[model samples]
Target: MTTPLATSSSVFLQGLALSLGLIVAIGAQNAFVLRQGLRREHVGSVVLFCAMADALLISAGVLGMAQALGERPSLARFLALAGAAFLLLYGWQALWRARHSNQLEASAGGNGISRRSALAQAAAFTLLNPHVYLDTVLLVGSIGAQQAAALRGWFVAGASAASLCWFVALGFGARWLAPWFARPRAWQVLDGLIGVTMLVLSALLLRHALTGL
Candidate 1:
């Protein structure tokens, strides 16, 4: 009774919902993106890089690369430790920012970092995290592969759309709170929240690494 168009739409929605659920979690990458957004510095490049990373990873997963990745447990373990270290460092930076909220401005010392630096940092945030590979490539990719061949593309399209929408919204929409964040106290509060998020995520990742889970 369902038209092909309707069926495709349903699959796309499923993909969008699933991808959003996975990405909406509070983690180092999202926290970095949020800070960039709030700073209004190179937000466009940051969002685009993250979305593209997810798209590439999801495509790899659909192409059966997740199986190859899954065979490398040692690689995952090594990356987990690296990721935990990076997250702890980022958390420390956030706490320092909170302590010196007077330095929190839209531009980095009124000049901001160059686009190249922003892009590099965004790429690191996207690629250096092992969980990103597991969630975007393996989990989302496996789910997308389960769809009928005709629907697989639609499913990916949906998931990609969700990622694009979320990053764009989070990056751009952050400015809407600029008035409130103009106050040093507000910036301190925001940094405090980011610091807590990074530390919590680091702890969770460290546990997962130790448990090999």
Candidate 2:
């Protein structure tokens, strides 16, 4: 039975808490957002794009897109494998850029990083992540599906709001670390961290693929 409005409020709150808890964890997505934030170049667009992307992905999850994907493991594996390859490629590019473009931080280019480029990077990074489907689509969708039809919206709303909040916070909040990253040594640390993150995500996807086989 669908919960009353009052109960629905509490349920949604719980869902929001859980969703935020999961989304707040440091990942490649978070790293990219943080990097853009600290650089202070096009932060707003990056934040908005990421939040919107999350909303779309989460909506699809709740709307049964994942079920169709799950029905095709072979296809899923293909995406997973391709995603893993892309991650490895991106990891390399991120490292090269971090090393070379570390100088571009303070200098404000007239046309900084461009909206299309930022959105492309975010979408590529987000969609190519194999775990995103498992986490947002499968896990979140299942939770939403379990709730009564009326209450289900509450759960999804909580989750979607969480994603927006997380990306915005991550994108804007990283500015605090700007001074620290100004140091060349700090770039090494940041670059290394991003590199390690990409590698970890890649390994996880490969492991998942192998296990599924």
Clashes found in each candidate (C-alpha, N, C closer than 3 A) = 0, 0
Q: Candidate 1, TM-score vs. the true structure?
A: 0.61
Candidate 1 per-residue lDDT, tens place, 1-213, comes to 334998899888867766765675446677667678878888888999999989878877765733543667675566556656666776777778788745323432344788899898888888988988877776666556555667877888888898999889768887674455457777677667666766765675578678875
Q: Tell me each candidate's TM-score.
A: 0.61, 0.59
- The residue pairs found clashing in candidate 2 are none
Whole-model lDDT, model 2: 0.66
Whole-model Cα lDDT of every candidate shown, in order: 0.71, 0.66
Superposed Cα RMSD, model 2: 9.2
Candidate 2 lDDT tens digits, 32-51? 77777867867888888877
lDDT of 2 at 113: 79
Cα distance off (Å), candidate 2, residue 192: 24
